[model samples]
Target: MASEGLHAPRERLTEKTLNLHHAIVSLTEELDAVDWYRQRADDCDDAQLKAILLHNMREEMEHAVMVLEWLRRNDTDFAGMLKEYLYTEGDIAHHED
Candidate 1:
């Protein structure tokens, strides 16, 4: 006989894991944009604009860390987190106006 009680929790865990993966992908894209903008901000001579950009970039970093924490909680691999950072750096070089 099947222990029906185990199935519901297992299903819920699977769903949660899928949701975490989705969040990770979406956050990675945002991190890319943040990198592009940060370089532009650094190049700007205006202090006010630089401050704003720096604030936004810091926020993006914070967000990435939050998503990473969520992924870690769910046993998601951390192997690619640094890869994402490196990719964002490359993006800064290629996409800067």
Candidate 2:
């Protein structure tokens, strides 16, 4: 006996797409968390806390840029991503350390 549907080729393309989507979502969540920390840093009076928060915010923006590039290459909405990136960067920079 020969396998019919059992031997059907797996949907590797779909799997990869799902994995990419998951990655983007995770990165977005991380960016949001970083933004929150940045906002918290604004309220912090301690210089050390402000410095750490600013550093983390910078790192998060870098990650966001990387993800945005990936999304652009993947034929995502580049304009929207660019707009969001700019907005987030501005928000992160609002408080000077």
Candidate 3:
């Protein structure tokens, strides 16, 4: 079945492409949830509720990173980009040089 995000027909997409699409969508949703939770936590007046929201947000971040790692493992381009930009101490823009 084709997800709503697909521009082309499902039949036209390769198996690897479909899988990648799923991973990308999952990552996006996880990140979106993280953002929503953070925003809610910031706006909430109750300290307990805010703490719960913050914890949930961290869980979503973990999910997002897992999906991102899957993408890095499956796609060489992402692997290269992550390797170059991630965990670096110097100016990120300098990596482009």
lDDT of 2 at 42: 98
**Stretches of model 2 off by over 4 angstroms after superposition:** 1-13, 76-97
- All candidates in order of TM-score, best leading: 3, 2, 1
| Candidate with more favorable, higher TM-score: 1 or 2 | 2
- Compose the digit string of candidate 3's lDDT tens values, residues 1-97: 4476987888999998899999999999999999999999999999999999999999999999999999999999999999988999888877787
Clashes of each: 0, 0, 0
Residue 89 displacement (Å), model 1: 22
Residue-by-residue lDDT tens digits, candidate 1, 1-97: 2222232455556766557557767578679868977997979999999998888888888887787666666653554544445456446555544
Off by over 4 Å in 3: none
Worst 10 residues of 3 by lDDT: 1-10
Residue 8, model 1: Cα distance from true site in angstroms:
24
TM-score of 3: 0.92
RMSD of each: 10.8, 11.3, 1.3
1-97, model 2: which lDDT tens digit per residue? 2212223354544665655665577577778978887998998999999999989888888887777677666645665656556546445544344
Residue pairs in collision within model 2 = none
